[model samples]
Target chain A: MIRHPHLRLGALLLTACLLTSAAPLAAHAVGGSDAAFVAATRGPAPGPFLYLGAKHMVTGLDHLLFLLGVIFFLWRARDILIYVTLFSLGHSLTLLLGVGLGIGLNSWLVDAAIGLSVVYKAFDNLSGFPALGLPRPDPKLAVLGFGLVHGAGLATRIIDLGLNPDGMIANLLAFNVGVELGQATALALVLGPLLLWRRHPSFLRFAGAANFAMMTAGFVLIGQNLAGYWLTTGAG
Target chain B: MTEAIQPMSARRMAWLLGGATALAALITLGAVLPAEFNRDPLGIGKATGIAALWAPDEVRIDPAAGQQPAASAQGGPIRTLEIAIPLGPGGDPAGKDQLEYKVRLPRGGAMLYSWQAEGAKVADDFYAEFHGHTLAEHGKMTVAEYRKVSETANSGALTAPFAGIHGWYFLNTSERPVTVHLKVTGFFDPVAPGAPGNEAGLTARVGSF
Candidate 1:
């Protein structure tokens, strides 16, 4: 029911914004049921951990929003792959090193940083960064930096879970593999609609509106996490 | 690659920034602040009546939550209470969740307490906080946290610094149901479970040590 010509392309972005925002409230990594399972199980359970990893990525709202922003404007397969690979590399490095070395961060702070990642990507996608007086940052580098923050967010959660020392390496590797698969699956779903919408003539005209919606969602995420951090730490 | 996006009109760009700020402010004040920190200055939360849709990390607690100080338990024996907490998804506890067992103490009373989760290992981890809250002159409550963590079991002692409602707050971050076995030794009163965070009643369940 897109009446105005400008409404057509804006529809998908609006939907994505509304859908992700609504679901994010419940999008944390661990629930009581899952925690019970992890606590009861001993030794290396690579398979279950893999499933958990995939499940986390699939349902992780912050990461998904950032990924959507990443692939939103990309039309070429090669560029998408290159950017995705960079992200994978950055996150993989941090995920493994952060947990492996016992590098800890406050979960709220990490989450807030991830939200900032979304805002950054959406601003970049909308060409908002260029409008500012500052020189434009390299998109690849920005994505890579944000990917590290996103990975650290998950790493902190895992570290809190208290991983078993036995067969930990194998389990971590399997979990990382699961994350890639889940990211790929989500990417396909998000990219398909974007590709289809872009084929329509209304896409170019309304693209600004769509990206702005993304920016709005991203800002909401940042504000929410920041609020959480402030309330918990009592820091104004 | 997206073509260089034609610059948006100044007014439109301003609208984007302004609109996003407004939306974020609205959601924060209406939903997030009330559900998370229970700070609802705007009254929009009570009028609309919605839980926080963005607070996934809030430390969930009993909905009818209030810290009612127990009467003097100066000569009372140790009290043990078994509590069953059905922790919901996410860190935020719902209204009327968690067994907030409290005891009132005079200036210098002490109590020994131990609690453990009974069941399969919980991954989400159970967070228990031993704290005391004192009502000040004008009914303003001030609190001090003694202990908080997501562990399967915890055992320790608490010494009251002042006359107040001192007790333990438990939140299960796990997915399955876990019963918390709590044993208290020393001077304290037994307050009932789920008494709107205030008042006293009979223990919900009593189990042998």
Candidate 2:
């Protein structure tokens, strides 16, 4: 509408590349000063844990990609709120219970499941399931189900860090609150550009191409996680 | 207002799905597997020079991992070093001219060190705090002060209390600039400048004795 649709599309694609390319290039593990902070935390350090939780959610590419896929097509604010709430509810349950009970799954497998959620959402965006003569699952239920996997993935990382058990409840609660804060922040960032882009007719025209790219990203994530699993377990 | 979807033909959808899967597989084999896991099954990553992207610290070789020895009792081979710590103008009592230097020592590893300050008018014109700290855990640091005093020179021997960093925080308190020459013989590694845990950013001079 303004001019130079090709340039706009190129810019959008470039942005996508920058965002998704970082996932493979960077290790998903927590390290650096953050790891030091986690290791050095003693008891009841809610403020720092909260900050860490928020930081993790914001920087997490797997979570971001899944969120993007989940919201790519939804237009109504009410629907967005409902879907996001379901996701929050699902993830919160596992993040709290899994860590509290000291239950852990292989981090790689948990991440692989998270990647599969992205793939599922992207495929649904393309209506690929229906095209295959499969009954489409309720979007709300699917989001919630995948949210549980996402939460478990987060829990695995926290568990790996060996957080102190003293005042665990308060710290975990603070972290959860921080995660929600981070989710809101990330949602705002993602939604703003999406809303602006939706106004352009190019959105509809290139929607398929965009979704295909998302699907590819999802696969890359899955492959990376599975490879991590295979290599770490020495199953190769 | 109409956000209804347009369905692709079954054949088109199948092709796109297959194409996406194939492309993703190619990328994973060519890039992610090599860079993240160090397993380049297809060899394309090596051919394309993508495997070099794997940082040395991040590359984990699993087969020998369990069999590898624990953190070394001594880092590398024994070494001797003579280093200089210097301060320029304004190196005065306001604590402006401060520098920290450290060496990594394994638990119970010993080092004999002698350091002398020159250009200071007297012993009181120079100050140093010799200390050691355990690697931080959970953001909490445990510091052991071996000595904290003001003097122009000191000679000491230390068997490290823990496997961590032991160092000197030197301050030239005289209005005139002062330089301190330090000599050490020991089983220790000079903490590299700008490395993690080298919070002071003081560069080490690696003159062998």
| lDDT of the candidates, in the order given | 0.68, 0.77
Q: Best candidate per DockQ, number?
A: 2
Per-residue alpha-carbon lDDT of candidate 2 for residues B5-61, written as tens digits (9 for 90 to 100): 477788988898899888889888888877766778999879989887764332212
In candidate 1, what are the lDDT values of residues A114-144, reduced to their tens digit? 8778777767766665565347798889889
Candidate 1 Cα errors over 4 Å, as ranges:
A1-27, A233-236, B9-15, B51-209
Model 2 chain A: weakest 10-residue lDDT segment is: A18-27
In model 2, the Cα lDDT at residue B94 comes to 54
Candidate 1, residues B1-111: lDDT per residue as tens digits?
555475555566567668766876676666666655555768876776754322323232331254435654455455555454444433445533354667666555767
Q: How far is candidate 1 from the true structure (C-alpha RMSD, Å)?
A: 12.5
lDDT of 2 at A218: 80
lDDT of each residue in A174-202, candidate 2, tens digit only: 88888888999999999998888787777
Per model, kept true contacts as a fraction are 0.32, 0.51
